[model samples]
Target: MADLIPPTGRVHWVGVGRATGSGLGLVCDEAATVLWGRTVARAEARLEELGLAGGAEPRALAPGALARELVPGDVVVAMLPAAGHPALAEVALAGEAHLVCPGYAAPGLSPHARRAAERGSVLLTEVGLAPGVDHLFAHDLVGAARAALGDRPAVAHFASHHGSGKDRPDAFRHHFDRAPHEALTALLTPARVIAEGLPRRVARPWEEVRRLTVGGETFEAHPAGDSLPFVTTYGLPATWRLESFARGTLRPSGWNAAWKPVLAELAEADAAGVAALAERLAAVHPAHDADRDRVVMSVRLGVHTDDGTDWAGEWSLDTVGDARESATARLVSVPLACAVLEVAAGRVPPGLHQATDDPEAVRRWLTFLTARGIVATFRGDGAV
Candidate 1:
């Protein structure tokens, strides 16, 4: 990935659902001047809000509707729920339009990817923040490590730490305060691990807990799928034991010490007990109840030389007003805008493409994000 890919054409959005703080909506709303959204009402409102009109027309997200009129050069952004993305990708592929998403590249999208390549179109996914910028930063780190040390890194760990908004009218509430054990309940869901050439997997979110301190602030971080995918994605050699993941969450401090009980309950499989525990946790990490809340995350990639020497890398971003417009939304959606351009120009050679797999696209796209107001940084113990 060239840092990241740039926009290659006029954008056409596929889903028209309510654009809350969703990445899809942020992309559609922000690129309103250049892109067309499928939902007529939402598109009109978004257009009116952005002070732009009809660069795109509102229509159903149906491919037949799209295929009959939509052809090459159109960009289809799939911001629908996780289950719907695969279908949407297929729709766009059949119509000869490009595809983009902030979501993971699930097994389902594989077929559409194959078809898109056959059709000579781009099928871009995971272009937003965590999955988007996160992968780009990791690839750069991986590439740099190779340049710095003769031996590729063996054991590597990746982690993302951040907090979501408290339950408001619509926002999902993030826990800020809970017993230390309570926090352990998430042992399986968040941190998942994959080692190079290791047939087995290890998941004990609680056991992987490590206290994280940044910016003079301290918090506990339980590994979240930080190291699972990278080893395979990078195809490291047997000597490499790569485990990439993210675990930085937004909280004042002492959050880790408080959530232990929740973890214990999770182990007990107490359904009602879990819900009650969740509510209690929210009470402690209550939303600021104002529109001024924020999300701060730092994704770090730690590396060890094949000789067992050590190094570190990081991309730390603090996004404010997340309740109003979350980092999650922007991270997922903005990449769609770039994918639109790539497909419009026919640069994406289909098949299955990973953002980190293409150095050029990764660099180009990351550069574009800086202009769009995304804060990015490269820090390492040693220079590339």
Candidate 2:
């Protein structure tokens, strides 16, 4: 492990987007916090909206603006798009400050991680919602299976989905920050997954939609990204055989039926046509203030030996938005807040790291999330 820079107890949180929620309050409670937004006024407004008007300082985010205020040992929490992470990371490394983000660890971050380790600064990623809590569940399940079955060969399958809790008759239910069509368009790209003990490419993931039941509710699920890499990340025993594995998005039941027309339109629509369709869909299905969002994630694993000894278990999270905060925002921000605190405490070594797999750290994070009313239930045949 590299020598970690002692934290200064000051945090600079960048961006005040929809995903930014009560988690900010948690960080504010423990650190001298500053909230950065597109403009100083926008940052101030968001603070007021979050009921944290005077809880933290508000600043405008511009090129070099955040870099100017950063100092060694400070923590920078990025709540912006994935594309902006590298730039913010550059700023953090230059200032010898730690950086944290909820997004996946893109390839661009590899070099930053090397530099961060050398500079004694932490760079934590994937500590929110599906990537965050789901990771905890997977690690715990795999650890339990290993203890019980001890490298025995077994078939394993994993899936995660996010859908609206409230039923909507429309084609789409959730609100998006960008063009909704782009999300649909991105689905055209292929994803890689482990299936039948081999890696396979899924050209049209949406075409392979399958029914997934979580917490007694059935929803539509399809793989979203490359999942083969996570087999190593989750520390699965090399001796175990994988039947199926995927990390995917979940949608309400009957999503395919509702999306059929939209998919057909996207197939042949040009750029201009797609933009028009997006505009039309936005108008037809505008989000309502009364709407409530929900997020559900489940990770299940099973192991078996030739003697027929078996171990099966699952950990699932189901949370809905409340008057206080949206479910997506709460789930995403709170775990991220937890990671920031851990980094501040110098528990995480300086370098690039995902949500911790250490048993104690996993327990601590899950317990903290439970106390905040985000609980993941475990149901299995064996003790975990």
Instruction: Write the residue-wise lDDT of candidate 2 on 143-170 in tens digits.
Output: 8888888886766665545554453435
- Candidate number of the best lDDT: 2
lDDT of 1 by residue, 329-367 (tens): 555555655554554555676555666467787777777
Q: Which stretches of candidate 1 lie over 4 Å from their true place?
A: 1-10, 16-39, 49-55, 60-64, 152-191, 194-204, 235-252, 260-262, 270-289, 304-310, 322-324, 382-384
Worst 10 residues of 2 by lDDT: 164-173
Q: Model 1: how far is 153 from its true place, Å? A: 7.4
TM-scores of the candidates are: 0.74, 0.94
Clashing pairs in 2: 161-250, 162-250
Question: What are the lDDT scores of the predictions, listed in order?
Answer: 0.56, 0.83
